[model samples]
Target: MEASEIFENEDFLWRLVRHLPENSDRNRFSLVCQRFRRALLPFRTKFLFNCERYETGDKVIYLQFDPEKPEVEVTPIEWTGLLPMLQACAQTFPTIVSLSIMGLWSGSSSLPTNGLSSVLLHPRFAHLSSLKISFFKAGVDDNFVRLISTACCNLTYLNLRHCCPRLSDQALHSLAGGCTRLQFLKLRGHDRGPNTISDFGIERLLSSCTRLTDLRLCVGFNQVTGWGVRAGHALTCVVMENLNHLESNALSQGLQGKRLKRLSLHGAARLGEIERLVVERCAAEVVEELNLSGRMELKDGGLERIARECRRLRVLELRGVHGVTEEGWKALARHAEALEDLDVRDCYFFREDCLRALRENCQNLRHLLISSYFFLQQRSLETFCNARPSVTVKVYHREKDYVVDERVGLSGRPLGSRLGRRPTLYKDPVRCYKVRRFGYPWFEFLPFELVSLGIV
Candidate 1:
């Protein structure tokens, strides 16, 4: 090879090496051949690193590191191993655009929040566009917010899950003020203290993250209620200066019109003024996948209003909407032709025909989960499969294997004259168990592959 070409090739290897995490793959590469090893010599200072796998590429990049790894003494040894690597990756790839730190609670039950100081604050992460920090116990405290603000300055997509003691309005303030570039944000399992997340935090978030195209915020738990109760304050905690915070009444005041393609709100039972606040205000038709499973009460016309407003709805979940009946579900399903996923578990007061109506009408349905004790019956199993040929049915019958589809058929004549005179329930000769005593019932285990009806 030409000397110039070799030099260019070496430079390229160095660039790729800088992006690799400190993991087994890099270790294997380092030992492959002397020339390869020498090419990787620049990164020899890295004692440990971690690998992050992306589903699309099928390639696992090892992010490498070095220097004195911080002593987060209280942090579990296994999880602590990645902290130094993360810090090093941030330093080396200052422009590293997409990064995610997930399952931080690995190797331990408790979340380690100490070693997170300079890791995110480093200028290297300033240009990071996509960031996801999962399983870390974070609070809305100044230090934590500072880390997020300083590090994810250019973030466009962010997912914060199960983090912190309480993520308050202050944290939302920092994110909205700083990460104005955000387009998609998900805040799941982020507690703002017990029954306390005022609209201040959500309003700031909605206001600041204006460019947000997808937003999922699960605010309250099962036990809170009312307009000012639990996460209820989140919706009313409106700020008009921010167009996104324009309340229903202030709709014409700000950016006046907007829409969301996907929305999921849980713990609706905590909302105090459910009838007026939730039903009247949230009348947007942009949702494609809507799950209202966490709310216990759906007032008289709540579900009907949703069916009327969310006309573009596709995937609807009314798992805990007990107030909804077969008629109400049918009303909602009428406009939901594009619907693909429907969960109707424990809405028992409704008739079984409601599901039949769905099977006949919602032909595009794919996944249907029904409770064992609800309106689900053995007869409807075949109807379901026949209606949506692409659908997979999961019945919850524990004691009986209700096989409605025919398995084996009676073909050839009986073997003997007297004993086999009459045709009996087709039994598998291989599965027929022998009896040691007289009058012991002849039993056989049916093959799961049997195609004909066994017993329903």
Candidate 2:
């Protein structure tokens, strides 16, 4: 075959694309949620060959030219410096769908709303749907609020979690007036803040943005009492964190009889209330995802009840709730035919055997996140993955620096085995955060193993 013909092959083109350099932008994953990853698509083309990179500076000393004791104050990076560099991306990728601007230093008050404000104001981003600006320091004042109101009208998903103290109830009101089509909204504010959002903001928002399906609001600071929890009909997914006593009841009353598909009582302590009010009220078959992360009060029967009711659950996140053992597993095994993603990261009581049902029944089971306390053996891993080849295991080992054994996985299966039962492809260990680096086990007979495995 000719060299041109070889290069022009579709497989060869994909091979070329796979080897390209990865993008250094850390905030990319913040926008893409697990809902997007539910398809289990390979992310090979999201890298950048042209995005600008940043570096730290080096200095010898502060200028003590004329004094015995001299001091200098280092200032935070100005947004003006970073804005021009990002313009290329904005200009090139004009119709950017999702934009998330997060993280401003604690003491620094000069919030850089300019960069995002410029992007939102651009005419090219008319179709932008998702905008998340979280953890930024104060000064989400009227200017930024007005900018979002006028510019981002077509937005469906907006997350302003713990963003700024200056983001008052009025800002939420403005957002409601403008973004009339928002389906997913997260307006979680900090506890210690000058700006407080009462039932006024939420009531206005619910009244205006009538198309809300998913909502996550922190009722920790603002006490939204009587009129706040009245509007709840089309809400399919609800995640309320840091809720107090009275607010929880109000939430229950509002959410009664709603056919919710996903419910997360995050940081909410009342397990009985959750089971009685939320679980009992919602349409059981429709509840696909349940996240009771950090709720220690969950009894085995509560989870069992969840299993019995929401049998079609696809995603289960029991991060710190440790009250289920065999009942939960058995329920998942029998009914969760659509189970795909499972996260039991901090559940110390759960073992590797807890996933036996999910392994057996759920044919499309792809991602499993478990604690290192769960004893996962080589044969067990091999047997599980051997049954279903598309499985990926992520073990959160508590050790600071963990290195796996070279021959820990089941590599050399028999030649006459199933076609899909190939070698175990281990995903990189996630540490600190989502800094994913590939894990390569050291093989003694590397070439021989490759040859035996028919890769060479």
Candidate 3:
């Protein structure tokens, strides 16, 4: 068969396009011909629209290729044009299952809520399973939530971030009544708003959304004292930030019997006796990732309890926690055999003996981030680098100055001199070969360099 004939076949094109992993690649492939575009249309399921305002007050809208990565194609549009764009998207991508719209600015112009509602409530989006609306200045309220609940009956994932100031407990009540099949929900409030959704709304939502597995509430939900979360029986992942003592205790008490896999309690600075209660009651076993960053009341006893209990822990973040001593770290190294990623940044009490203990015991450890507030001897760092060359050690000194030491070769030599600069113990211990490759030609470029670098 001729090459042109093979390329013209729609079935062949559809098979190839379906296997293309990334949306960017599929989009590029569709540009080949009309036949390729038609073949790729069935698999196009996601639509992303972002409108952001820079410091200079210029508003730009664009489509984001990947949500996890920062790659965008800017298409500037007026505030009034948002409705038409959404309407066009609904008409063009009738089979889209996931939709994300971000208006990340506090502009003087009000949002066209009527137009937005018309497009969202359109029959073309009846099967939409995921919807994310973020950072709108105004117009999102209980009525809008009710409209979404009434329209998107199949929605399983909903994320609202800094978008709803007028949203209150009544919105939650509406969602609970209409969106009973929701599995994941994230509500991040604006910093300036009053606490609109309280425990009553949370309790109602959890009780109604029986299949909810992952729930995250970040700033602005100050009224949520953790009592509302106790109703979630199927929750496996939970992230709550900037919680007070009462909230932490309530959350710990609520999560007593649930088997969570990932839990992060960021900025729970006042978790004193509640820290132990959290470990014993909820996160004793089965939890894989735990982040207790900025919990000032965490002590050696709490550390010991976590090490002994959470044997399945793979990722541990203890940033800004200074109460743990060498004894607690030793206990952690002895017990946490499955530990792979550990971040002890801003921990001033971390010592050389703890590093040695971790280097000797943690076989699966691959990433270690420590602060340079208390310097570890160069000899100890070199020893650690040589022994566990697979592990990438990052010593964070300040916001801008940090060292990343990655494994160089089978010899396990630290890539310090690769940067053509001397390695200093406190200032710069080692530089990554990935960063060095851009400016230097002496270092041989390896295809696997990025994977080995482990840049977070």
**Number of the predicted model whose TM-score against the real structure is largest:** 3
Model 2 poorest 10 in a row by lDDT: 60-69
Please give the range of 10 consecutive residues that has the lowest summed lDDT in model 3.
46-55
Name the regions of candidate 2 deviating beyond 4 angstroms.
1-78, 82-108, 111-130, 218-232, 242-248, 271-273, 361-364, 374-379, 399-456
Angstrom error at residue 257, model 2:
2.2
Residues 176-279, candidate 1, lDDT per residue (tens digit)? 78887877666655333342334556556666666665555554321211122122222222211111211323322221223334444444324333333333
TM-score of 3: 0.74
State the local distance difference test value for candidate 2.
0.56
Superposition-based RMSD of candidate 3 using all C-alpha atoms, in angstroms: 8.4
What is candidate 3's lDDT per residue for 1-456, written digit by digit as tens?
Answer: 333443456444453332233555544555433533343233222211221132223444433322222122223333445565555555555355666776646532355266567877877678778888776767377888999899988889999877766678999999899889899998877666664788789888999999999998887666777767788889998888764434556766677787889888887546566456556767567889998888778888888778788889999999988878778788889999999999998887788899999998999999898865425655677678878877878765442233444433221223232333333322121332323322332222222332332221
lDDT of 2 by residue, 53-79 (tens): 111122111111101111111122333
C-alpha lDDT score of every prediction, in listed order = 0.48, 0.56, 0.66
Q: List the residue pairs that clash in candidate 2.
A: none
Model 1 residue 310 CA deviation in Å:
3.0
TM values, all candidates: 0.61, 0.64, 0.74
What does the lDDT come to for candidate 1? 0.48
Q: Which number leads on lDDT?
A: 3
Q: Name the lDDT of candidate 3.
A: 0.66
Error of 3 at 425 (Å): 12
lDDT of 3 at 368: 94
lDDT minimum window of 10 residues, candidate 1: 66-75
